[model samples]
Target chain A: MNEILADIERWRSAGQRIAVARIVDIEGSGPRDPGAAMAVNNLGEVAGSVSGGCVEGAVVLEALELLEGQRDAGITSFGFSDDEAFSVGLTCGGTIHLFIEELNW
Target chain B: MSSIYESYRDALQAEEPVVLATVIEGKNVGSKLLVFGNENIEGSLGSSELDRVVSRDALGMLEAGTSEVRHYGVDGEARQDDLSVFIETHSRSPQMIIFGAVDFTRALAAQSKLLGFRVTVCDAREVFVTRRRFPMADELVVDWPDRLLERIGGDLGQRDAVCVLTHDAKFDVPALLSSLATSVGYLGAMGSRLTHEKRVDRLRSEGVTEEQLSRIMSPLGLDIGGRTPEETAVSIVAEIIAIRTGRAAPRLSETTGHIH
Candidate 1:
């Protein structure tokens, strides 16, 4: 969140609704630890990151869904350990669990 | 902007040592309690009792600069897993105090800053210990290393580092002597094998125990065969990481087939 403070401030000033994805837990060799965050505005702009580029795209998609009111604030796990082989996964083979939510609070 | 977020941003941006405890896997998920330094921070994690217990634990996490999920029962009972609170600690950046403003001092200071350490270059010689020489350093102290350590040593902890680059016995002895009195995690010195051998005897004479001497990584840095100052700086910081993480510094040729 510290890394994206500037962007969040900019988007907020412009009255852009934002959604944030925070890594709540990581298993095995994750490039980033818990609390790594990424924010996405309603316009699809991104700020910060929750992984080493491998999962940011997927996180952005989840954040966008939240912004679009397609989902409620909840947990979304991604990694090699997931059943979907074709899904976005970390190259390092680590699992990361993210809590996706709107910045309404 | 939400008042809670405004206060959180203000405390965190100032590097005032704050913690944000969030309920990620429990009832009332997304609830937040912002704990900053000893004050009853804004927001709460459900109940007042839960806030009190989490605040105490958050302070401990803040001091250690670690982020992790801790389990607790509703209302914060001791031996239960009804809730999981993510305690994210935003500690002030760890400090790296480099004694002696030499060529290595300049390179090391730059490297330390890159690694997010608040660098302080200390030397008795005012001429060398100028801001122009070490512009990257957060602080330029024109004082003996012992005096500087005496003032701020108590605050030093496991995340902090002290590097004594001044091989001169006059400076090195007092520097090591006073540094031993602090809880600073990493104590390293710059020198060759011969210089370290001599330093051991001098430090022993000055009453530094063998146990204390063991903590000092004399002849600092991994044996990366780095000749240039910049390369040596990389090796030194790598060594510091290895020391903190307890990873084996495997030289390529010396290691068995496996690199992992």
Candidate 2:
């Protein structure tokens, strides 16, 4: 989050809506620890990263969906361990739980 | 009046400790509360009782410099999964204090900053400790390493590091003695095997116990065969990470199990 603050402020001051996705939990061999964050603006620009390249593209999509009101703010899990057939999985075989929501607060 | 995020941004920019608690599960998702180091709070978790309890726990997490998801009842009761709050702490960054303002100190300071450490370069010679020499260091102290440690030793903890790059006995002896008294997790000295043996004898003569002496990672850094300052810095920080993670400093291709 500290790394992306500058971009977040720039986008926010420009009157662009933004969504934030934060890794709430990780299991097994996770590349990044919990509290890792990524922010995506309405324009699809991104800041920071929740995973080591893996799952970040999917996280951006989730953030965009949240911004579009396509889903409520909630926890989304991505990993091969899940039975939900998550196409995007971490190469390190780690399950990451991300909480996606708008940056209104 | 500032919003919760404004307060959080200001606190973070000022390097003041703060924690932001957000509800990720249960009622009122996205509700946030900014818990400052002074116990002051802004915003709410939709319930005053819940806010009170979460604020208390957030303070504890802030002290530990950790972030994680916690479960609680609607009113913040323990052992209840009615609500899940993500407590993200922004503590003061960990510190790396180098006792020699030499070429290695410059490289080490830059490398430590890359690893998110607040680097401080200290030396007894005012000529050696200068901002021009070490622009990456967060602080430059022109004083004996022992004297500087005496003022800040109590604040050192398991996440902090102290490296005595000054190979001279007059400088490194007092530095090692004072560093031994601190709780710093990584206490290393840069030297060869012969120098370390001599230094160990000096420390023992000064009444440092075998156990206390064991804490020092003399002949510092991994066996990376690095001789240059830049390469030595990489080896040193890698050793620090290996120490913190309790890894044996083996190459991933040669080892099994988790690579993280």
Candidate 3:
């Protein structure tokens, strides 16, 4: 969050709807720890990251869906054990749980 | 009226200790409660009872400088997972107080800053401790090492560090003695092996116990075979991280288990 505050303010002031995804937990061999976060604007611009560049694109997709009202805010998991494993699993073979939500608060 | 994000951003920008507890898996997902170190709270985790319980837990996590998820029953019961709150801590940066503003201090100060430590370079010689010399230092103190420690030692915790780069006995003796009095997690004195042996005898005579002496990582930093000041700075900060993480530094290829 600290790393992306300037960008968050820039997007907020520019009247961009934003969605935030924060890592709530990591099971094993995770590159980043909990509290790692990323924010995505409705325009698909992104700031910060929750993983080692492996799952972030998928997270951006989740954020965009939340922003578009196609999906409600909830927890999303990415790992080798996930069904979409081949497409967006963590290369380190760790599981990461992220809470995706619009930045309404 | 300030929003929760505004309040949180202000606290973070000011480098104050703060925590954000968000209900991520339960009724009222995304409800946030901002918990400050003083036990003051802004916003709520959907109920006064939940707020009371989570604010307490968040305060503990803030002190440890960790963030993670915690489960609790609705209305804050003891053993239930009805709600999962992600308590994200925003603690102030750990401090690195470097004694002696020498060439090594410049490298270490720069490296410490890179690792997010609030670096302070201190020495008795005002001529040596100059802003021009250490542009990356958050503070430059032109005073005796012991005096500075006496002033700031109370605030030193398990996360803070004290590095004594002064090899001279006259300055280092007092510096080591006073550093032993603080609870700083890392206390390392820079000197050759023979110099450290002599310093150990001096420290023992000064009544520093064997256990207390063990806390000091003299001839500090891992044996990374680093010769240059920049390389030595990397070794020292790497040692600090290893100590904090409770990991013995070894090659990743050498160890097979969890890398994290």
- Which candidate number maximizes DockQ? 3
| Over 4 Å off, model 1 | A81-84, B251-260
lDDT of 2 by residue, B1-260 (tens): 98887888889889999999999999999999999999999999988999999999999998788899999999989999999999999988999999988889999999999999999999989999988999888999999888999899999988899999999888999999999999999999998899999999999999999999999998999989899999999999999999988999988999898787
Report how far residue B253 has shifted in candidate 2, in Å: 1.0
Q: Rank the candidates by DockQ, best first.
A: 3, 2, 1
Q: Pairing residues by index, what is the TM-score of model 1?
A: 0.95
TM-score (C-alpha) between model 2 and the true structure: 0.95
Candidate 1 backbone collisions, by pair:
none
* Weakest 10 consecutive residues of candidate 1 chain B by summed lDDT: B251-260
Candidate 3, B1-260: lDDT as tens digits: 99999999999889899999999998998899999988999998888998999998999998888999999998988789999999999988999999998899999999999999999999999899998999899999999999999999989998999999989999999999999899999999999999999999999999989999899898999999998999999999999999999999999899889989
lDDT (CA) for every model shown? 0.88, 0.92, 0.92
In candidate 2, stretches whose alpha carbon ends up further than 4 angstroms from where it belongs are A81-86
Per-residue lDDT of candidate 1, residues A1-105 (tens digit): 888999998999999999988888888768788888899999999999887788888888888988887887888998773546666887777788888888876
Instruction: Please give the distance, in angstroms, between residue B95's alpha carbon in candidate 1 and its true position after superposition.
Output: 0.3
Docking class of 1: acceptable
Candidate 1, DockQ to 2 decimals? Answer: 0.48
Give the TM-scores of the predictions, in the order they appear.
Answer: 0.95, 0.95, 0.97
In model 2 chain B, the worst 10-residue window by lDDT is: B1-10
Worst-scoring 10-residue span by lDDT in model 1 chain A: A78-87
Residue range B152-177, candidate 1, lDDT tens digits? 99999999999999998889989999
Docking class of 2: medium
